[model samples]
Target: MTVLVSGGSKCGKSRYAEDIISKSGIDKKYYIATMQPFGEEAHLAIERHRKMREGKGFLTLEQYTDIEKAEISLQSAVLIECMGNLCANEMFSDSAVEDPVSKIVSGIKKLSERAGLLVIVTNEVFSDGIEYESGTMEYIKAMGEINSRISAFADVVTECVYGIPVAVKGDV
Candidate 1:
């Protein structure tokens, strides 16, 4: 089964995704950490997430990009902590990878092929209704497109609002 959990920051989407994946009855749970720590805030957030998953029995795979190449058991359940960071890393990275959407979607498909259950966490973007710079706008557009594509194929699509999950598609 594939699930997409999305919402604003601190909306409890990550916790919800973790809870569902942990109870999935899959013995091998893999947490694919996609965040790339670049600054103090990033480091602190990474530490916080590490602490959260300390006892969750997840073998962490720090794949900032190219998630399809991540090595894991075929029967393992995979939880991709987020798409925002992954997208940013791919878009603004030193590499010459073109079209972040295609790259990410391909990786997701590959992971789905390899894992038993795939749970993806993404942030809700373009909700502020404020004009951003060209580069930022490009990112927002990319995220919106990526989320739409994922939701289309995901078995479950949920929006976490104030720790409450409002189902947008199939049930989790």
Candidate 2:
């Protein structure tokens, strides 16, 4: 089953995703962390996430981009922490790829096929309605499009709002 869990920043979406995957009855759980710590805030956020999963039976694989090439590849259940970071990393990576969204979507599909359950956490990009620079707007557009595509691929789609999950598609 492919589950897409999405929400705004600090909305507890990751926790919800983790909970779902942990109870999936899959013996091997892999956390595919896609974030790259670039600053103090990001480092702290990474630490917080690490602490959150301290005791959990999650073998984390840091695959910033090109997930298909990850060493572990997949497991009984895989939780992709977030799509925002992966998309950004792919878009700005040294080996530039056209249509980063499509590339990542394909990677997600590959993971889904390889795992018994695939839980993906993504970010909500259009809520603010704030105008960004051209590059930022492009990124937002990609995220919106990618989220929709992932939703179609997912068996269950949910959005976390204020730490509460709002069922957007299918059931939890």
Candidate 3:
């Protein structure tokens, strides 16, 4: 089963995913965190997230750039926090760096197949409004494409508004 939770920053998408994982009845749980600590701000943010996961007793594996590696290695239920960062890493990486949406879809499919239940967290960037700059517009377009693809694959698609989840797909 695949669950996709999307919302703006600090809207509780990560907490939603974590709650689902904790209640899924899966014995082994692994958190595949994609965000890399870039500086003090990022480091502190990551540490805070780490503490939250630790409170739930989740085993976390920091998979910075490669989702495929983590998917192949996991035998338990996996929660991949924030697809946006993963997409950013792929876009900036030196690899082939072709179409990002296709890469993300393929990665999600692969990971979904390997885990008992795969819960993906991503930001709802499309609802943020139109962008004036060319680069920002392109990024938003890419994120929109990725969001659509992931929603299609997701067994449960949830959108968080003011820390409340409104089910866009599947049961609430």
Candidate 4:
């Protein structure tokens, strides 16, 4: 099953997605940590997540980009902690900025095929009425496009509102 869970920051989307994978009864559980811990805040968040999964029997794979390239067994259940960071890494590279919609979408599709159960967590960053700068707007638009494409192919699409999982496309 392919599940996509999306919501605002700190809304329990990551925990919810983890639960989905943990309860699936799959022996090989993998947590694909997509965030590149570049600074103090990112480091702290990563540590917190590590503590959360300390005893969950999950093998953490830190793949900042090209998720399709991550090696995994066919019987494994994978939880991708988020798309926002992944997208940013793909978009604003070290030398240049590029559109990441197709690359991210394609990579995720390939990952879904390889894993027994795939749960993807994404952020809800579009609801705010304020307009952003050109670069930020590009990111928002790219995220929307990528999410739409993934949600179309996902078996379950859930939105976490105030830590409550609400089904957007399929049962949570």
Candidate 5:
């Protein structure tokens, strides 16, 4: 089973995803962190997440790109977080992904197949209705498509608002 949890930044989607996976009764939990901590802010965010999962028995893997390349077995419950960063990382890398949406979706599909329960956390970026430069716009468009595709593939899709989860696709 795959679950897509999406919302704006700091909306509690990550915490909700943690709760869901912990309750899944899968025993083994893996937190597939995709963010590459580059500076103080990023490092702080990573620390906060680590604190959140401190007591949880999750084996954290920093698979920043090419998630399928990670050697970890996926039978355990897996949570792939913050797809927006992953998309941007792929878009800006030297081997820039021509079709980032397809690549991200493909990677998620491979992980989903092996994972007992796959939880994906992404951002709801389009609701703001703001225009941006071409590069930023391209990234946002790719994220829009990627989020849609993942939602369609997931068994459950949720949008977190003020720390509350509102189901968009399936039962919570």
Candidate 6:
């Protein structure tokens, strides 16, 4: 089964996803993290997230651009933390790859089919206020599109509010 959990920043999307994965009774769990530590704030954020996942006893695979590599490595259940970052990395890659959304969707479909259960975490960018800058607006628009595509493919879609999950597409 494919699950998609979305929420704002620090809204418990990751924790909720972890709970769902644990409750699924899947023995092998992998946390596919797409974050890259660029500076101090990024490093601290990554470390904090790492600590949270580590406390749950989840085996993590940190990848920046090649999600297919991590997808292929999973033997059982997997939780991909945040698709937005993955999409960003794919679009910003050195190689000129065409149709990044298609590529990402294909890879996600493959992972969903191969894994016993896959839970994807993404931010609901459209829920926020409109962006003032053109670049920011464009990025948000792209993220919104990606979120819609992934949510359509997901068997279960959940939205988190103040650390509580409100089921939007499937059973909670």
The digit string of per-residue lDDT tens for model 1 on 17-102 reads 99889889899999999998889999999999889888889999999988778898996899998999999988888983778898
> Which residue pairs clash in candidate 1?
none
The residue pairs found clashing in candidate 3 are none
**Lowest-sum lDDT 10-residue window in model 1:** 106-115
Displacement of residue 148 (Cα, Å) in model 5 is 0.9
Worst 10 residues of 5 by lDDT: 66-75
lDDT of 2 at 105: 88
Candidate 3's displacement at residue 39, Å, is 1.2
Clashes of each: 0, 0, 0, 0, 0, 0
Whole-model lDDT, candidate 2? Answer: 0.88
On residues 2-112, what C-alpha lDDT tens digit does candidate 5 reach at each position? 999999989999999999999998888888888999999999999999999998899988888887765557578998877988998889978787787898899998889
Q: Write the per-residue lDDT of candidate 4 for residues 20-72, one digit (tens) a residue.
A: 98899999999999998889999999999999888999998989888778888
Which regions of candidate 5 deviate over 4 angstroms?
none
Candidate that scores best on TM-score: 1
Best by lDDT: 1
Per-model RMSD to reference: 0.9, 1.3, 1.8, 1.2, 1.0, 2.0
lDDT (10s digit) by residue, model 2, range 17-42: 99998788888888889999789988
- TM per prediction: 0.97, 0.95, 0.91, 0.96, 0.96, 0.89
Which prediction has more favorable TM-score, 2 or 3?
2
Q: Provide the lowest-lDDT 10-residue window in model 6.
A: 66-75
Show where candidate 1 strays beyond 4 Å: none
Q: What is the lDDT of candidate 4?
A: 0.90
Q: Relative to the unseen true structure, what is the Cα RMSD of model 4?
A: 1.2
- Total backbone collisions, model 5: 0
